[model samples]
Target: MHSIAFRLVAEEEEGRLMAQRVERRKLRDTINPFELPQSLFEKYYRLNKPGFQYLLDVLTANTEAPKKAFAISPIAKLSACLRFLAEGGYQTGVGKDCDVSNKESCM
Candidate 1:
């Protein structure tokens, strides 16, 4: 029947859409925040290198360890947080700056 054929076509379309969604999701490339020049780092994070290192050291134990291989590192998380605070921008913008694809990760 035409209804049965339409149902099959719908299922095929759904499968193709799922494949496209999967293909679009990929691990985003990240940059090392610590590798930035000291001035640029301070400018973005509003903290000097030593202060940032101290904060990172203090917070490292409190931060959740990455469960997945592609999970963001604590350093990146902190950098994103500080950047968000310093820049007063949207989470997505901060995520892009931190190379985090997930805006929630920037939070």
Candidate 2:
């Protein structure tokens, strides 16, 4: 029936939209601290990449696994946290810089 066909088409469209969203996220989350210019890294994180990685290592030395599925990378999480700190500790600002949703950055 036309109704069934229309429902299938709608579902396919939804799936395609979801795939695009996932693709965008995958692209967004590939940010790497080492790739950033040293000046920019220091300005934002208050440390160079080596220093940041050292600090991250010390901080996460005893960390446990996250209680969520598909957790963000440590570097990404640290970068977001540093961005939050640098940008007056604003969740929305950090989210914008990190290409994450405000809710995700807050969490």
Tell me, by lDDT, which candidate is best: 2
**Candidate No. with top TM-score:** 2
Compared with the true structure, what per-residue lDDT tens digits does model 1 show for residues 12-94?
A: 99999988765444423344666677887788888998998899899987777778976666776777788888888856454
lDDT by residue for model 2 (17-96), tens: 99998976775566666766688668777778787889789768878867776577777788778877877777655444
What overall lDDT goes with each candidate model? 0.71, 0.71
TM-scores, all candidates, are 0.56, 0.67
Candidate 2 lDDT at 59 equals 69
Off by over 4 Å in 2: 66-69, 89-107
Q: Candidate 2 — what's its lDDT?
A: 0.71
